[model samples]
Target: MADDKSKRDFRDRDRVSADEDYEVEYFAAKAGVTPQQVKELIAKHGNQRETLEREAKALRGNG
Candidate 1:
């Protein structure tokens, strides 16, 4: 469950953060990757901001 905990700490789901919906686009743009690539990154890593950013950087750096 360690990975589950890293998927963001927003437990109360009644209100959704606007940024959460745009995570794919945001990270994709920030990392110069595609939205689909961002989704793939999420699958491999996690939805946590740090994890997503780290993976995005690694992906960009790898290419």
Candidate 2:
């Protein structure tokens, strides 16, 4: 018999997928920034959620 199980590693949970519009929008809302801003930040910073959050705050003068 073969195993039939699903694996959920969640390895990239801490990173954002800029290619995904929903993820971008979600991060934008969470960070209180616009999607465009989020995209730019992703380009500048390598999709690290924490870094993007900090950058978003700094962009909004909150950090």
Candidate 3:
């Protein structure tokens, strides 16, 4: 399932950067999703590693 966060390396969430193309592309690759998905995740969860990890863990629990 898309919500199953355990399958992904949440550590990649720590890569902080502006909404640049390369940053987005890198993050998308790290998160194992598309660049669009990376943007959406950043928009939805904010660009903080702690925040993303918490949200991801929560999403995992809910999965």
Each prediction's TM-score against the native? 0.60, 0.81, 0.51
lDDT, residue 53, model 3: 47
Model 2: runs farther than 4 Å from truth? 1-8
Candidate whose lDDT is highest: 2
- CA shift at 27, candidate 2, in angstroms? 0.3
Clashes of each: 0, 0, 0
Clashing pairs in 1: none
Name the TM-score of candidate 3: 0.51
Per-residue lDDT of model 1, residues 1-63, tens digit only: 123435766563322122354645655776688888877776676566666677778888999
Task: Please list the residue runs of candidate 3 whose C-alpha ends up more than 4 Å from where it truly belongs after superposition.
Answer: 1-15, 53-63
- Against the reference, the lDDT scores of all candidates come to 0.62, 0.87, 0.60
The 10-residue segment of model 3 with minimum total lDDT is 1-10
